[model samples]
Target chain A: MKRKISLNPVTRLEGHGKIEIFLDQQGNVANAYLQVPELRGFEKFCEGRPAEEMARIMPRICGVCPEAHHLASVKALDALWQVEPPRPAKLLREIMCCAHFIHSHTAHFYVLAAPDFLLGPDADPARRNILGVVGKVGLETGREILKHRRYAQDIQAIIGGKATHPVTGLPGGLSKGITPGEREEILSKGKSCVEFARASLQIFEDAVLQNKRYLDLITGDVYRLESYSMGLVDDSNRLSFYDGNIRVVDQEGREFAKFAPGDYLQHVAERVEEWTYVKFPYLKNVGWRGFTDGKTSGIYRCGPLARINVTEGMATPAAREAYEKMVDTFGGKPIQATLAYHWARLVELLYAAERLVELAEDDAVLDPNVRALPTAEPGEGVGVVEAPRGTLIHHYRADREGMITGVNLIVGTTGNHAAINLSIRRAAEKLIRNGKVSRELLNMVEMVFRAYDPCLACATHSLPGRTPLEIKIYDSRGNLQERLWQ
Target chain B: MAVKKVVIGLGNPILSDDGFGIFAAREVECRLPAGAPVDVVEASLAGLKLLDFLLGYREAVIIDSVKTGSGRVGEIYCFTPEALRETVRLASVHDLNLATTLELGRMLNLPVPEQVTIFAVEVADNTTFGEGCCREVAAAIPQVAEQVLVHLGIESATG
Candidate 1:
């Protein structure tokens, strides 16, 4: 009789992920499946609504990446109207986008990813958290983190309406313009961010890169997945978060596909599984090769790592140097280590801070000519941006009167859905042995997805749920035998 | 001369019954007197970010949606801060939990309210995406608001 082990962390009533593993007759790990309950009906709910409402409404879908959604929706509106925003508006928009990246990456590195590497992965569960991290780094650093986040959020709030669910983006431009004083404040804060980012990288170096065991873990096999990479890049093949062509690189570090945001339909496709509410997006040309990773497999990774892999180089000088250092550290392009996402995130953080200063220094950012009224008939439009998690695409179709007729969103986490599931399964296969599962093994498996930094709170965004990371195990006959709640 | 008070409504407004908190808070705000010594904030954030809303306030009353699994839909419960012991998981893989955030805030000498009050309304569905609350959850918003007002020592204008 074959046995089955189901780690049902499904106690949280809100939308979350559940993992179930099937065991062979010998009680060895046979296969594992990641089941995610997604918040449904965004597309259906969007129909018949005013297309312009997308800029205002899309952000409300998830508080985590509202800035990404708001900007993408507004850009889509621009394409729909066939009007370009004035240079000042574009500069302001990009500045806000950079701030969004900084605000997001700061929390991610300090609160989530830092603990695993900084305090050691096998550290006591009680001490392995943001509190522990702040405690280890000292009070001043914690204050620094909060203050920098405040700066980033202030910049965002000043330009984008609210820092969380922004409403400033309009069809051809922005609804508001910053005064010279406001611009100066932003510039000053942005300069502080540059210092903070450098200090952060130094912290990463002192905490992880400088530590040999952590470095090995970064370059190790447990989390390594040799998959294709995808992100956005400018004409010069430099990383650009706000705008550019969607670029996909092969597993061997060669250009796989590069196309405009609208051409995303032709290059990528989604695979809907019967077990999970979420859809797995894969490269169309490579075809669906299940959960496997390789050159030929459609499975590809995204977010910070993929963005680093796909782009030729970073835009700003400091970030370019950081990027080169990271690439050199990994012995070249196409880093396959999942733990390297933390390093890539810091590099991008530096880039965003530099970009913020560059944008703020421009007099155009303070120009009052922010809005370019749209006059063209509304139609279909697709907008894409490199969100903190990865590539976030918003495609909308509207009628002549600008009422939305159709909507599609390929979120950042969805891009790496297949790869995330695969990484979890791979770790489980290696760690879990003949009918025995330990706390350490479970955490290692948890760390596999943690590196990807998938925000179920963003993806799910449902309320009335307790905690996350709960596990319930089932025996061969499908009866619950043991449970683990975290 | 009185301590400043804040009423924070948490949860994503676009996700079905999850918006119950926002709706209740909105109702509470609507019923307040012209110069009530309180600040009402509508937020969709949690964890460390949520702490940003609670700073400098002498007292805070948080209204949000919750599912205890054993409770009936539309049930409302008032909870103390100590009741969140089993709550280790955070709103984001990128955030600290309520307890941890408050601890860090006090540790860093950030002005976090000590007199905190939490109220959660039972909901039928939060995973399904739609605007406003659903069914009984929608009906219970007014009552939840009334409960919040009672806790705040304010009488409802309706009754």
Candidate 2:
């Protein structure tokens, strides 16, 4: 007899997804599949639009990380135009990106991921959320997190002209420049943000590290090692969020390759499966590896863990120190632990804040000329930026008349397709083999979903529904035996 | 001379009819006399940030796209601040809509024009990735522009 279990409408993440686990006659897990059911045809729709319009159109990909798309689109256009923006413009764009990182990562850690950490695995389903965290951890921390998010948005709004989708970033430079008064205000806030980030990090450390039971609750038998990792790496092999070479590292933290962003297509190939609209992107050399045991390796993880593994160190002093501490405490190797994503995110938050302060104090930031005057030149260009979730690349080709001829976008979440599916499968196998499915286990599977911090809505357009776990049993001949559909 | 009226267009042009406000603003700007008291500004949705332009004006007209089901594509809905509050749903946090923005402005105790009119064009294709307006909505542009001119007490060519 064969059995199948389906987890439909996966929750606690940005968009909709489903997981299916197949069981053989022996009641053992055979194959597990995870599917994200949304379709966002940004690349197809971008075809035949003006290259300059990419800056405006691409940001609509995600309301959460619009700044990332904006920056990447502008960079691609810059490459096409063969013009580097003024120093002030670059600094302003970087600052805006850092601010976006702080807010986005904080939201993920506190509001989305913290409930799993603080509420314990067996905590009530109803009470396992931000509100529940507030009840257990106190109102001050929750309020502080909210304040940090708002402050980050406000800073981005000042520079980019809006928080969600800022239109200020243009191809050659910014549509509007910041005043000295605005610079002073941003700097002061940047200083306070550093203190806030440090305090938040301390809270997470005390909660997760200092408390042995809490650590055991969240970590025991959760994380698994199976695939290689990818992220942005600076020339010095340090973790970098902005412009850098693409680094792919194996499970043991060995560098696979560091290639330019434009070379991504040569290495990455996307395969479409019948289960979902989200494409399975993998290292072309690995071939068609499925989620489970297969010669054709498929799903792999990206985002924070992959980023940290691929890079040797962090760029900012505070983040680098935190990274060292995390490694030392977690056995000094590439952490396969999904729970550590929160720790890595907080570290990046600190780095972003520190970097923001440094950039704000620079004299070039106050320069009156923040834009480079450039006429429309027709050509092909590529732009890459590291969004909060992962790498985002934009490619555009324009005609001699400056009209767009082609557009190809490789968003951050698409890069993590294989890993997310694999994580879901592993979690499902563990729960099904034990013959028990608790809400906590469901949440754990959801945690893997959260670990990738996927923006499914941005990746694809799909309908929303309830997330339920179902299972079925079958024989070797694909004969249905027993089933549990919930 | 008639009271100078300013019209502002809001929303992303790439998001199809989300650029309705901007389209109407541009059309109204082109129809008015060169030295007319009306100015048109193109802005992304900024809820409170719009106050900088609205202040010190005697009258201002705002043209935006409406998702309401009460009318057809070219159907025009006119409302004052008080009347708009009752009919339109103010769910957006961005200052993209004139109704909620005016309400926020009043709450912030900022200077606001005494006469404010809003022209909302019903939208059917707000999610498509393109710049030009749809055929139905595109046809309504001239009428919407004329309505704004008439509201501002200016002699429009159509009128």
Q: For each candidate, what is chain B's TM-score?
A: 0.91, 0.84
- Individual DockQ of the candidates? 0.51, 0.06
TM-scores of the models, in the given order?
0.96, 0.75
Error of 2 at A442 (Å): 1.7
Please report how far candidate 1 places residue A319 from its true position, in Å.
1.3
What's model 1's overall lDDT? Answer: 0.84
Which regions of candidate 2 fall more than 4 Å away from where they truly are?
A217-221, A292-300, A459-486, B1-159
Per-residue alpha-carbon lDDT of candidate 1 for residues A255-326, written as tens digits (9 for 90 to 100): 989999999999999998888878999999999988898877999889999999999988799999999999
lDDT of 2 by residue, B1-159 (tens): 766567877655655666677787788877886577788876544333455568767788777776654468766677665565343233122212345556444543556787887677777666555677788888878888888888777776434
**After aligning candidate 1 to the native by TM-score, how far in Å is the CA of A485 from where it should be?**
4.1
**Total clashing pairs in model 2:** 27
Q: Per-residue lDDT tens digits of candidate 2, residues A1-486?
A: 566656554545554456666766565567777765453345667766667788877777644567898999998888788777888898898899889888788877765677777776567755555556667766666556656766788889899896567788777888888898989888988888898889878878877778897676445555565577778877898877767898877666677667998788887788888877667777786667555423346345567777777778877788788889878877766777766777778888898899999889998888878888766566878888888888887888888876787887777788777777677777766765644555566667777777777776443221111123344445557666555543
Off by over 4 Å in 1: A8-15, A459-469, B87-94, B157-159
First chain TM-score for all predictions:
0.96, 0.91
DockQ for candidate 1: 0.51
